[model samples]
Target: MDLSCFKAYDLRGRVPDQLNPTLAEKIGRAYVAITGAKKVIVGYDIRLSSPEITEALSSGLMAAGADVYDIGLCGTEQVYFATSHYGMDGGIMVTASHNPKDHNGMKMVGPESRPISSDNGLNDIRDRVLEPFANAPEQGRYETLEVMSAYVDHLLGYIDAGSLKPMTIVCNAGNGGAGLVIDELEQHLPFEFVKVHHQPDGHFPNGVPNPILPENRTATADAVIEHGAAMGIAWDGDYDRCFFFDENGRFIEGYYVVGLLADQFLRKTGGGKVIHDPRLTWNTLDLVKAAGGKAIESKTGHAFIKQRMRDEDAVYGGEMSAHHYFRDFAYCDSGMIPWLLIAERLCQSGQTLSSLIDARIEAYPASGEINRTINDPPKVIAAIEAKYSVGAKSVSFVDGLSVEFDNWRFNLRMSNTEPVVRLNVESRADKALMEAKTEELLQEMDRLNKN
Candidate 1:
């Protein structure tokens, strides 16, 4: 009944302490009760604690009179796929995404893959689980299902090998669940892959299995350099987000990947809508517009973007954080889709990854997405707003806070689960203005905090 396991968009915490079998069971019961779902599907990542949690959750769901479909050991998207694939009432994924091995979490979706955020049903579910209930339904049952192979088939269905160009690429799974996909992908795809940390080790002896960190990215970049690959790709624990490294061993901002994928998707399905987070890149907006497709910008998060995608019937949506969603996949984001399309683009253009993103970097230079610690983020944002609101061309609070000018823009937002403010600055190829504006904003944030 300790509700700390519930988070902003999912249920996540450390094992046994913040999370355990008892807690998972309670969550399952509460989820079924709140959603009124008669049947539910479940999946998990490659953590040692996953199996135990999955079993406990299933017990809870059955207790609540929900028929459970157990899809053993799969990525988060696979659960999303199953929820839509089997026409189930709801689904749950026991994963922490890219969180450390010590951490685990759950993501739930109602019918139609609609999210259960704190405002919608997560808080209600938490309240239900908080109260002790001894009696549960006795007429429920569970069935096992293996959908990984089917999920793989769906991934390949979106692209053709004949359209894929041959190139050497480095891929680092960071010892996460992506190894399963990489192992099968090397044999099926046309690219020559240089592998690093491809084995799934729950201990995460290499690192936390997140390509976002500079340390975790070293192996992937080194592999690209060593093999003289065209590029390097890496994934987090759940393989929902894919990061890229150019041939020069430079880590490309995921925002660029958003643009790259948008361009590719727009070319295939011209004039379709493309969704992107507002944190970084006007390049996405430009590319989408230039390609004759409508650009829809949303606040930064998977839940918000996915909701918008369904509402707008967008063909594709991507966030600078590396989550990519496709309309054909029931508005679910997959780490597998971005690279597949990139490969297709390379084949069509006969260009390498470096060549693909170089023109974008020159066209729309960025401040490289920075995160900073601040004791009081609101005070900093307030001060910035007060100072800039007088003359700013526009000020928006769609996600956190964004202020726009004639030729430059920046957004400073508080992290959902941390005491840090993430800042992203962009300009129309004016490097000096971007640096000066970034410094000024950081100095202002520091000055206000020290006060």
Candidate 2:
């Protein structure tokens, strides 16, 4: 086994080479062995390789004396929902999640849909999968299940159906797994959906299904403007993370969405704790405080965010990368719930999406996350820390290097899943300062790269 395929939070690698059916089967057996799970749930996305990998995984699980329940061709969160909602022992979803078409991976969770990350037995499973073991004398059985209706019902539970306005919503699934769910959901919604690339095509003919990239965002934005929709939403390959654009076809930074959702949840629940990542803070902090809710900072990554939410009993948590977690949804991130809640909020308040966040955007001007590929991430981070810590009011190594002053702050961290350093800067309603600092940081990174 090429252990490099294992990541900090999940398995992701180039397909057939780093990950394939053979490795997936071994992983499936090891998962059962590690968790002692008697009943396992398996699901896959729209990727061409996913169905074969799911079959191989199920075979291994059954061979290891564990019964398998297969929920075919679904999003990543469906596995989470099926596991926790049906009281299954564990679950795995075969998805690369916005990676290149040549790549594939798996996301695993234990009972109650708790993630099993590298720190939490993923490495042990990796090691165990390498050794040979005999199959159980009595092989377990496999069964097929349908979870969409129940899943749609759960999604609708997050908002009142009657509260939705007869507005037009532009939905661009990017030819990924989100289309299926959107199609199923439309039957129950009052809004008209302007669908773009709505079919699930593993070929990814419409692009790689990642709206976070600037190049991939134009389709949704254009559709929204052309169709005169009230809002636009785009999802990644597996539909775990969602990106948003306002009625004017302008993309809203995910940082602002975090604050927006935090405000919404606080108002609904009469105020509760909210968790956010350290990369971007001021907007979320101000909104959270204004809503009479506590704001807690957590390390970035789904595993860390979910665990922190569980520990704090937070009513809501959001990452600027578009992952939103809710206390009611087993403390797991869902791409579907965030948009539903936003829709409901717009309807209830009779406000445009852009109008809702315009003030907060002005109050906390930010440089959206920028990424640079470097030879040595740790050395670059150390250099940044050495340069900034001298004049900073506070410095934190919570996730990476976060230096804070009274008026400006920034966090530079290495991505867990990619070979790059990400930088995010924000200022107290000063866009010029934010841009100047962002440029300075980029120049510094360039200097280090040349050296």
Candidate 3:
């Protein structure tokens, strides 16, 4: 097994090269041994290589004396749900999650569906997978199980199905695992879903299954405008993250969605702590405080966010990247719950999706996360820090370097999953100022690159 395949949070690498069935089997065996898990749940996404990987993983797990409950083709979160719901010892989801078709990986969770990140147990698994081990005397059993019905029930439990309005909503699954769940959800929802790229094609015939890229977002936005839909929803390949667009076909930044959802939860539950990432904070902080709730800042990334949420007993947590975590959902991030809650919020307020978030957008104009590829990320980060620190009122390193001034602030940090530095800037209710600062930062980044 290539140790490089193991990342800080999960196992992700190029297929057939960095990761393959052989390595996958070793990973399975290692996971079982490391966690000492006797019973585990395994699931795979709609990727061409997933079935083969799943088979190898199961073989290794069974060899390690683990009773494997194989939940056939599923989203990443389904494995998380099944692990906790079935009271299993652990779970693994075979998916690359919006990576190129040539890429594949795994996300593992221990009992209670808690993540097994590098700090917790991933590194141990990596070391064990490289070492030799003998199989158990008697092989454990493997069984196929269906989790969709229960999964759908769990999703429905997030909001009142009877309260949803009968309005057209655009759903662009990007030909990933989301279509199957959306199809199942339709039977239980009142809204009319205009499906786009709504098939589980492992080939990803419709561009890479990521909606965050501006080039990949046109289809969903156009569909919303063309159909006069109330909103548009899109998801990554594994359906672990969900993105939203307003009725006017405007793509809503996940930053505002954090505040919107936090406000909704706080209002309903009568006030609780809301956790937000450090990337963009003014909006979420202002909204949470206005709703009589406290806003806590957590580092970015699912494992970190979930851990912090559990620590604070936070009612809701959101990353500006569209990863929403709910305390009720075992503190795991879910792409399905955010939309359902937003739809329910729309139902209760009797307001259009666009109208609900318009005020927040105006109150805290932000430059949505802008990613830049540079040879020296650290040098640029240092340069940006030096340039801003002199006049900064406050600075933080909760997740990344966030420098705040009297009316504006920006966060610059390297991405854990990708080879780029992400920058987010926001000004207190001033779009022009936010734009100017964003440009200034970009220019600085470019100058450093030239040097």
Candidate 4:
């Protein structure tokens, strides 16, 4: 019983060896035992091993006296959508997300589509998997649940579809499950979709669908330019997080998208809280305030952002890493919703994506996110903090060490799962200053690492 597949947020590991039908079934039963979920929603991604694993998981749920509503061959958000949409007791998505193709995993959520991560129920479920399971007094039933139509309708509800005008939009699914969704949404919109790597293939001929990787972006960027699209969008394997490319075929950093989405969502809500991560702030803070919305910072990661969204009753939440959570969608991240809202903005404002983003970039120049592998992340980060905090106007540690001056700020935080430290620096209306400060910080970090 190698349960190494269980992770901080979800379960992810190599197939068969670390995760297989055997372990999946146990996880299913353990999930039921821990959460007391009677009616569970089960879904899987476009992975090669997903069907068999999902079947085993459903069996375990059934054996534990929890009826299963199987939503087959969908992305992770679909599970999130179905659980809250139909008022299921809980939901589990069998997906590795953007992990390597050979790996598989699961994302679980309890009632109201709240995440069941390590601190809450995931650890309990993992421990329970070690125990023996008994057949329930009555077995739970299994039925295929067709949630696509309703789910699509829910997605379209997020935007003004009538305002969407004719334009060429590039969508590179990267052979992941997002294509299925785009196909469903295509009929409702006025835009002409330039589909690239559009088919849902677990084979991932275009390579794992993680558009965040610089190498994986070319296909979408190239297609956007080739088709002269208004904009381009790409998604990870499970499509929970989506990346964007402007009309000029340039990849837009997720931080900018966060600001854009915050502004767009705030307009619709009239005025509401917009939740954001601490790693990068000034841009989002500016946009959020300009939209007449208050900004709240949460520690990064889906669980933290989603929980914060629930607590604040936020209209929308976003991370520089591309996860966008919407309140109307049960505080769950949706790769689809962000793009539709952006399209609507484009149509209504009659502004190119680049023009909209460029102004924000000029207002707040950022170093993006830079990761450095260090032998001692804590020591290096602390030392950097000591040196940088001397004349800093403010310093805080909501998620990481953020030291701010009048016009510039930088945040250095250790990766939750790795020895790498990520650094992000930004300056108010000064790209040169931002670049110079970023270089200085990286050099200082490297020097500290050597010491």
Q: Give Cα-based local distance difference scores for all models.
A: 0.86, 0.92, 0.91, 0.94
* Candidate 3 segments whose C-alpha is farther than 4 A from its true place: 417-419, 449-451
Which of the numbered candidates is closest to the native, going by highest lDDT? 4
Ranking by lDDT: 4, 2, 3, 1
Q: Candidate 2 vs candidate 4: which has greater TM-score?
A: 4
Clash pairs detected, candidate 4 = none
- Candidate 4 minimal-lDDT segment of 10 residues: 204-213
| lDDT tens digits by residue: candidate 4, 217-289 | 9999999999999999999999999999999999999999999999999899898999999988999998889
Per-candidate count of clashing residue pairs (backbone under 3 Å): 0, 0, 0, 0
lDDT of 1: 0.86
Tens-place lDDT digits, model 1, residues 335-379? 988888887777788877888898887777788778888988888
Q: Tens digit of lDDT per residue, candidate 2, span 242-329? A: 9999999999999999999999989988889999999999899999999999999999988999999999999999999999999988
Relative to the unseen true structure, what is the C-alpha lDDT of residue 308 in candidate 2, on a scale of 0 to 100? 95
* TM-scores for every predicted model: 0.96, 0.96, 0.96, 0.99
> What would the TM-score be for candidate 1 when compared with the true structure?
0.96
Model 1 poorest 10 in a row by lDDT: 131-140
